[model samples]
Target: MKKKLGFLALLLVITMLVVSACGSKDEGKSKDSKNASGDEQIELEFWTMQLQPTFTDYINGIIKDFEGENPNIKIKWLDVPAADLSKKILSAVTTNTAPDVVNLNPTFASQLAELDALVNMDEAVSDEDKALYVKGAWEANNINGTTFAIPWYLSTSVTLNNKAIFEEAGLDPEKPATTYEEAAEYAKIIKEKTGKYGYFPSMDLSLVLQHMVMMGADLTNEDGTKAAFNSPEGLYAFEYFTKLYQDGLIPREALTGDQRSTIDMYQAGQVAFFDGSQFIVQVKENAPDLYANTIPSQAITGKSGKKTMSVQNVVVPKQTKHQEAAVKFALFLTNGKNQLEFSKLTPILPSNVEALADPYFTEAGDDAEPTDLVRIVSASQLDSAELLVPPMKNYDELRQAMYDAISASMLGEMTPQEALDQAEQEWNDILAK
Candidate 1:
């Protein structure tokens, strides 16, 4: 009886061991199955700068449509304030939590490219895909021959004139200035006749820089180590602006004022012309009476026939885990059809070449509003619009130095040559370190 009990206990022990092994194997298989299934799904995070409140519906619809077309991929969207984008992106990058894709202006995009934080789209984008965008817009994101981002929306400054003011000044409202010199001449006449300021150049922005580039001043040396704006072309640019200030063609406040001040002047009928993108909408909304007298004209061109183009672009980060999916979504977002749809909702112009060819952009109805005319005129200049400021790591500092020198020259603290030379020296010192 004792031997029989011992055998039964041994059998029970062996049986328990077999059962436990089987359970462990099954659990391992289950875990493997779950992982394999999870691997099939791809999630992407996307960020845009200050596009949320106004474009939430449109963007959400696009996301839904994209998910439907690509069932395996999911996108997580985040809208960041324009002012906080750079800081937010920097923090995300530092933590290795950067979004798969993000929207940024060319300036900020270039800064990241300099840091090697952005993917080189030139290597990833096909030639056929590259040809879809405007040449200038496409090139705007290219730094050191590597394209780091894809162009999305674009704008070029156009001359907006107060027709009533022009007429009162005895200038032909129908024939607006097409060149900077012509603009200056018109400014003199307007101020002389109507006793109102003619126009205020945007000193805070890149207007003066664009003018210099238009006059053939190279922004930097071949290696981008030092300032090249101190050349003869640079001197011409300085002298031109100095002459405008001395002659009182531009408002004195322009040397220090922001775009808001200029817009105020235009709205109050204190100025005849205001050079900007499709800002007529604001004028229409803020002062309907001023809108009635506003006329849109082609942007003032330099001898090069190139207008200053500013581009907003979408980029994929190098740290993204889902590069293929992220790039595909980016291309989808900026495709001709989608870009055209976005343009219809806002006054922005599309960077896609095919979108520009769309009838919506090409045609203006007989009863088109002043804003419509502005859009038409602005769109017409896209072909000739080139980015005046190329992507450089120290661009902001360089621009500030140039602005300071220009300000000094305008204030009579330094001659044009002296101001430019000092600015050039400062720029070289900044780049050296």
Candidate 2:
């Protein structure tokens, strides 16, 4: 009887052990299922202009660091060619595959901002964050009081001189023309002395026109109801380009050449003085010896003596799912340290004033003086810069037409006034449509 009781207890112990093992397996299964409720990793898409080989490492390194810190989020970069940006972005948006963030021209930002395709960053950005950019920059991204983008980088038309050309013409190589008249006189001298094109009126008329508009033309008036381009101010700009071309200060090629070709001419030293982007730092880096003479440009004096600058902005697309992350990234990219890094790699100015004080400029080498030139250009953004025309709905088409008309006039197919008058009618009609 004792032996039988002992056997029963042993059987009970074995059964209990089997039950405990089963319970442990169930808990393991439960924990494995809980992964469904774990934090969902998010992915974001960002787009930027084409970068040269020199800047590839800097950009990729920044992105890699950001990803390391935020492993929960993944970033996919879409680099679009600067020339095909509009078409590519628009196609992507139209097809419902747009990037979460886009680095775009302020002109296009205004147009997209107008279409309600960008998120209003006003509520997302704090007053302190808002203070990061120069006064009118954020305002430039706002259309009708709605902020759609944040200023990313600043660019303005600045004069670049070939020191050799200046010396040959008996002009001061160190002191570039402070006024348009002075620039024109130097241009005249350059043409006569060297037989090279003295200057290239910006191939893009919008740049020159915007400066004229800011100087007081007001293409669209204060009321925003009337067109002002037919006024004396408008005609003044028309005459400026006409005079430059007709006076032989600029070559006939410039009348139809775009910014790329114009810059190419300047880099080749074929043009003595050229209006180019403020971002000469990257240019200097690319061709160290050639860019030795580049400097921060000031506004060419219009008959009115006013100066103006232009800015490019970063925008958050309306269709993005990662709005907060995109905003954070945009701010990070444009903040003091990063903006300075970008400015060093590219010729674009940092939108942040604090960045202007950074050692990148202070510790720059002789070969890197253009970095300081960029810093000076960045500092002038607040005092001298103004918004380009608010993006218009049919902007690309309208701009092409305007350029065509102006080019036709330059080719002697029409007069400047006639081209502008037709442009006014065409633009107003497009707006009405």
Candidate 3:
């Protein structure tokens, strides 16, 4: 009777063990199903800053091509207005639904990198693949030794001269100013002879900042921790820009109005020169006859002969689940062929080294070929392209202070030094906060 009882106990223990093993297997399978679902299909969201109208189809074509090659991957694109992209991106990031891929100003990319929100794309991209772009463009995406973004589109600072104004002012239309001092001289000449301001240098603080940076001034220090706009170079740049207005060379219309009005003055043959990006192509396309005499090329030099321009970039966010795919798509979209095709539709230049080699670059339209100017500016950028100072925590306030000071000084309310002194103090106070 005792032996039979013991045998029953052993049987019960073995049966319980078997049941536990079956449960473990079932649990493991459930967990794997969750992981498999995650791996099989990935939905990606992307944002693009506004480009030329034709660029819409070009970007969509790339999306279609990517979808064809990657059946399991799906992309949803959002076209963000250029003016609102930074604001929207910040809002989305706070909401935890940010786009997997974002197009941003290079300055903003640097800010995102500082925030630890950008992915370190070292494992996602290869050195060989990176070699395809112009030298500094790829470098621009790197912060603290980690590459977080890629260069998708590029435009360089080029001077757009109104040949008609040049001729009307009795200046050589074939040759324009190659230095700021020269441009100013030309402005004065145009104003005197034509009774139209030679150049209405727009009072966009951003443009003022860019040209200051071009003049070999450290807009921000090396550590990215301080403003150097009070340096000698910075003051020199500030003085020159203000002189255009102070000497009554630039019209009040330009100092008070925005880009639209600035261009309107040019179209009306009221200005001799327009300094800006290659997007002058779009402006020319929109009013061909009025701009028939337009000539586009490099920005003029400073006392030191240095040159610079702002750039926008595409960055992969840290929270993206499809990081590898996102990086791959960025590279493919920025490939030489695609950039060349896209630039044709936009005023931006191709950052791809190979893309600019196309014959069309030499003959964009019936307009005068800018081979000499393009070569000079492109060459300068290869060695000296620098991103503008990233927007800081108090960037808005700081910019406002600077703008008010500069504008006040330009309006003869204060001298340049006095304005800069006040600006420096105000900026330093903000830094303290």
Candidate 4:
């Protein structure tokens, strides 16, 4: 496989998308499916998130192989946009028409599990099969102790630093910040010495909770029934950002921006380091100058010293008529071989533990491209990665409320403690619903 295949972690912008709610099962026999007695031709509907033009042949070939092996079954694949997938799924369930399988991230997989809309992987898949994937990646799709999805590809952030800016700021490019505190210090020095922003932190809705989790804040109780993040760790997260915004260290738009803004800042040479690797390809294409000076390092952590993991998984809807077949195809699609093959064509990592152990991931040589180094760093980061913000019901609503409260404190509307109190109250109310 080449050093760079394609970049997609960038395409997963909406962190909490809803891919829940399976439709009513169909029992009637059709030409495309089985007979009333239940053994006949079956046509399974499958959905994916935005892989059409670039990986059309790749997916089509997967379907071909699966169909060839199971000659009685056919696959119908549809690629969905990240933003629209949830809405379409909810609509599909209402009309009693839903896909057998879907591609989703950890953010909202729990929502489906809450709705009792997804197949329980703990019962559907065997123990031997479960051991095939990276423990963290595989468990990310788990709700409570029950698994709901098959882990596909995974990604961990690699801090993208501009060498020129570091040099100008008199900071060592070889040693980027390892902790959030160090990152803040680096930002201050970068801004003071180079007159360029040190870093861009997006305090957006989804990210507010994510950052808090990274800071060792547990957002909910053991059963995830209520808010538990109003603790010391959570308060520290708010204070950290609030101080940064007040001191004029981070970008003013940090209050309202998202990762896209962060990417724009890096490409425009407005920020020194971007704690994400998804947009490096963009830097190469739109800002080759910056790309030429791009250096990759492990992402900054909080108290946990762990990087955040981004996992893409596939789930079988709970009530699909062809439950067994749906589960089998999903398993096959995300098996070590298939995942490894897919990772070879993209910048993502395979969740398959065996696939992850391949030399390609473990080694990026001295003469490797910066992008390859990015992979090497990211691969290592996975060893200590996790979905810090565990799955919960009404996740979007809870995060939005918390984000609003945090923003209010940062903008001088309330004290940090007051904001935490308000956020905690709001979270409890949402959980109560």
Model 3 Cα lDDT, one tens digit per residue, 244-291: 777788887666787777777777777778764443545566668655
Task: Give the backbone clash total of model 4.
Answer: 0
Give lDDT tens digits, candidate 2, residues 121-180.
Answer: 898788999998876677777777788888877765566777777787787778877666
Error of 4 at 201 (Å): 1.7
Candidate 2 structure lDDT: 0.67
lDDT of 1 by residue, 335-399 (tens): 99899999988888999999999988778898888888877888988878888888876566677
The count of backbone overlaps in candidate 1 is: 0
Rank by TM-score (best first)? 4, 1, 3, 2
Model 3 misplaced stretches (Cα beyond 4 Å): 1-39, 51-53, 142-146, 276-279, 282-286, 362-385, 388-393
Of 2 and 3, the candidate ahead on TM-score is: 3
Error of 1 at 415 (Å): 0.8
User: TM-score winner among the candidates?
Assistant: 4
How do the predictions measure up, each by TM-score? 0.90, 0.79, 0.81, 0.90
C-alpha displacement of 39 in model 1, angstroms? 6.7
TM-score for candidate 2: 0.79
